[model samples]
Target: MSCHVLYGIAGSIAAYKAPEIVRQLKKSGYSVTCILTKSAEKFVSRFTLENVSEEKCYTDKEFWREQNIHIHLTRKSDILLMAPVTANTVSKCAHGIADNLLLNCFLSFKGPVIMAPAMHAEMFENVAIQDNISLLKDRGVYIAGPIEGELLSQDLGVGRMIEPETLVECLSVARFPALSLKNKKILISSGGTTESLDPVRVITNKSTGQLGKALSNMAHLYSADVTMISAGDVSSIGFKYQIEKTASGMHDALHHSIKSHDVLVMTAAISDFIPEYSEKKIRRKDNALSVSFKASSDILKSLSEQKKERVFIGCCLADEDTLIETAIQKCKEKNCDYIIANTASNFGNSKRDFTVVSKEKELDSYSGVSVQEMAYRILSLV
Candidate 1:
């Protein structure tokens, strides 16, 4: 049977994206029903959603006109998705306010809940809104994106809603292959490691740890005991994690922790070279300053040597032409069971092209897939 999605729309200029979101969901084989808040109707029409979803649309008026409607909807739906949820609605959900039909349904929904926040940059970044978002995340609600992009106000920042196609893809991939890794221990490393040049200056790559974060989340969803070693902020991740800012720190953390885990996925961008650190900050000079660089420790290769019965997965970032070849070589050189290969251009992207390779041959490849789906494919092999 197809899964039923109770799609909720709240007040925001981004509400106009609702019809397309519904269309994408239906196209992906989900039966969708939409509910709009009173303020949401000002931006999007019920008729449009009905036409796209081919399901009944509900509003606050229907909440009063019908008996036990919210209860009935929650009983039938497999999941509840709130796209373009505004700060006001976020606050309501956090505070248990059910003044509107959507809020009421959210309160009663028993299944997985996903929310995509959309608003102006300032409003989205407000302390109250962040606190509300944190609360929802703690309650196991999946928050998709308020990714950086152009807003309705013609300014570019971090309040734009993710596109409809990506949202649907993430939701679809999250549902299946359920609990496949239950009771398994998985260790993941993420973010770009820094190499200090001086007390005040350091060199780091462009990795934002988005892919690692996605992998960790997917592993947790599959019921794996997950421990993340991250070089970036760990505030948003819900599972067990430790912060490791430099290559040496990450190496020590992983080596110490990998003994107990069954699998190790090395997604962290560890620096290949480390510069000679200066105790004092380097002063500016007209002439070019030269620094000596030494090779850093090979964390993945070293871990693979001591893997014993544990599976090791490594990642290779290269140009498109050599991505697969490099990954295959790395798999053998690092003694990895699997290697995920991608282009450097795909760094920090929501959707990216990936090719999974093993020591023997290529396992699977995908184009423009969400990180959630990529993580699912990688775990399925294990």
Candidate 2:
């Protein structure tokens, strides 16, 4: 079934991003109803929203219609998404002030509520706004960013709307907690580890930790206790991190925490080999140098001691011909519940196309899937 999303946009420079939010949701097969504050019209026009969302954009006048707009919307919406939520509206909603159709719908809706704040740096940093945000959070509203960056004030600070991709990811995570990972412990390792060869150089893969962060965010949305062991800085913020600079360190971190979590997702592109290192930086010299290399133990192979039935999901990079076979083999070898065989074509792309397999055989395959959707699928499998 398609999720019904009532998207509310407030008065902020970030309102310009509203259309893309709607578009992405629709692309993900969501039914969206847009609500706009009167002041929001100054930045984003109704015509634009209507075109993008393919639904009527409601305003304060909606309540005057024969139908009770708020009640109607409340009954239909599965999630109330307030994006680019200005500080003004944040204060209003926090105080139970239903001055507009959006707030009216907000109060009437009983489902999940997701608010992404966007405003001037000064306005966001104001004590009143911070308190209001806290109040909303206390009321069980999921709060996204207001990430720190260039604000509408032409100054850098903690007041920029999070990107549409992140907002979309957050919305998906918030909308469906039915597959609630409530009380389940998730230990995830993400990003690519770098092995130091010298002070000036190291070996690392192109892995950016995008999928790991997505999975963690989804797990968090479902109320799971998540601990991420990252190879370096992860893309998503707000997760507890255990940073490891080398493949050996990453192996140790996972080995230590593997027992505590119900699920383990190994997405880090760890170095297969590490070179013997010199304590001092290799100086530029006339003589050519050759460093001896040694194979590193595979992290997944060492999971034999884990108790049976612990869910393990692993990702492998390989060619199409060997993909499914490799995934199935690895699944059995590592005792993984499921495995994803991703081809080289999607190395750094926003969308991933891969085959999902179990130890015995191929279960399913997904193509052209967003990282957000990827997170959703993995959770469903779990």
Candidate 3:
């Protein structure tokens, strides 16, 4: 694969490391192009970058359109990186206030962009800065760290820029393994489904989707093409929990998106019932109020009945009683390869107790394991 890298420089003491970063990128078999902000030029000279990268160093937005360089450069590069990104640059990028050439390039680029922030520990921990990071994450930007070390002012704490070698190593480690599930497409349904009671109000379960998110990330780690359906309003527990949000505009994502995967993991704790007649506004209450309830659609049963050689995994939650038998019954009823049955009262809140039930034999009970470990065990069964 021909890898093209765009190096975006920001104002920091670490800006002096730009040349080394470019050299490392080149050493790793990447074609490097450097984009420098004005503040960055104070530390690293443009001539140094031009000599290292053998390409033009762009600092002016007018120069970009003057020669159509930004568009061409963006198209040429497969990955864009902003190392030693200052707080100001991150805020601008996060809010889309692209005044300079580099910022404009970030705004217009379509490739995977990774940022490594450098700032004082206090500034890095500032609420606004953290919110800017969150905004970038919501927009699907990848971030490296402002590692801990000595500061420019002779102070010591976090917010030191990660070194060039570290950055390159991180880039090359390969987040997803090579073609492990080469031709397999996987569908994962996660998070709790809302049962609408009104236009503004709904009945929903307490599923945080920690398990489903873990499975999706592991699937991606194994190089499976994964699509995680329904994850908005739920927090993912780890780095593996990266999925494009497709549930923002609609409810019941499982029924709508269940048909296109080689493996299906139904880890969502779907609401069992919903109001039969939902009101547009909240039901006005003086004292006590009640609404008629009915069963919502059974997403897993539909998929199981329509299965065509796809592996299916289902989950069952029991409160205080009937863990093993209920789980086994669910396995048979759903025609799934495995059933992950655990307690509902303490599930996702604390370390859970679970038993893996298959057609041949019920596995021994395991407990005190974190949700992530449980997820790993479940994936191992496949």
Candidate 4:
């Protein structure tokens, strides 16, 4: 089915760029409908937007009489986009202010919404905007960026709207989330599992969990249900990491919660060993401390043995020998259908050089792609 995207423009100096966004969406084979806030029209003329969109721009109190445009448009769109979303409009959206045609549609509609915020650095940094952004995220609203770069005015800082192409990439249905596992369910495990050594210390790995989260998000976009279980707090701040707890209690919680999911993509760098005797509180008297550790339960192997019908995918990152051999061995030992193998040094980096090893195929490689693309490719494979 062809995708239809509703573009909402708010008041901002960046409004002038809205037409280009519409044009790009159209070029990408999306049916585009543009909605203009009254404030936005002041910055970019309706004539320009209407001319580019080739569709009537709605922005009036008499919206219903003018062809019941709001409902009709809402029913037709697959996604809603708010570009150059100003601080004022974001606050209004956060607080459920349906004072305008654009806001009214946003409040009443049920569809994926993406926002690309633009404003002064100070206003964007305001607590209110931050709270609103968080609120929107909780509601499953996707945000492209207020990516940092030079601003329209002289001052250099963040809050500039992301370029149209980047926005298109996020919304693009044509080229992403590689083909193998599209429309398939994928579960991912990320970060290093912490084994409490003492109250203050834990045994953990250097894993940053970037690979797993990237894979999770990409699988999600490809119409797969994704569950991410991490041993550490992953946030997007550095590598789009989000803080997630990995305490023993939390692990149990996740284990109990998982149901009849089909695919389990295990990329998490789980600790194989834990302290033989962990104290509830800190052990203070330090005198050449020696702690013995026993191997923890093999989560992937156990799951593979228990769930025979599901597809189990594993990751093996090695530093010494040829990665393909290690990945194949790991795949066989773990009873996984596929293994994504790469160098340990490639972890937490922008570019990924990895190979896909499955029972049916010897090797297929992907590299020099964003962690996101790497994820998409992996998901496509199944």
Q: Please give the clash total of every predicted structure, in order.
A: 0, 0, 0, 17
Question: Tens digits of per-residue lDDT for model 2 on 1-382?
Answer: 7798999999888899999999988987888999888889899998999998888988777766647878988898888999989888899999999878888888888988988888777888899999998788667777777667777547897778878877777876664545656678888888888988887788788888888888877776565678899987754423456888788898898989988887888888889999989888988677887888899989987865673667888888888888889889988888888888898777678998978899899988888988777777887877
TM-score of 3: 0.51
Candidate 3 wrongly placed segments (more than 4 Å): 1-182, 234-256, 280-286
- Give the better candidate number (1 or 4) by lDDT: 1
What ranges in model 1 sit over 4 Å off? Answer: 1-78, 81-175
In order, candidate lDDTs are 0.85, 0.82, 0.72, 0.72
- TM for every model, in the order presented, reads 0.63, 0.69, 0.51, 0.56
lDDT of 3 by residue, 102-209 (tens): 887898798767788899999999999999987885565666666667797799977887778757644532333222453567777777766666777767667787
lDDT of 4: 0.72
Q: Pick the candidate with the highest lDDT.
A: 1
Model 1 residue 229 distance off true place after TM-score fit, in angstroms = 0.2
10 residues in a row with least lDDT, candidate 1: 170-179
Q: Which stretches of candidate 4 lie over 4 Å from their true place?
A: 1-36, 39-183, 234-258, 280-287
TM-score of 4: 0.56
What is candidate 1's lDDT per residue for 60-129, written digit by digit as tens?
9999999989999999999899998999889999999988889999999988888889989899889999
- Candidate 1, residue 248: the lDDT equals 96
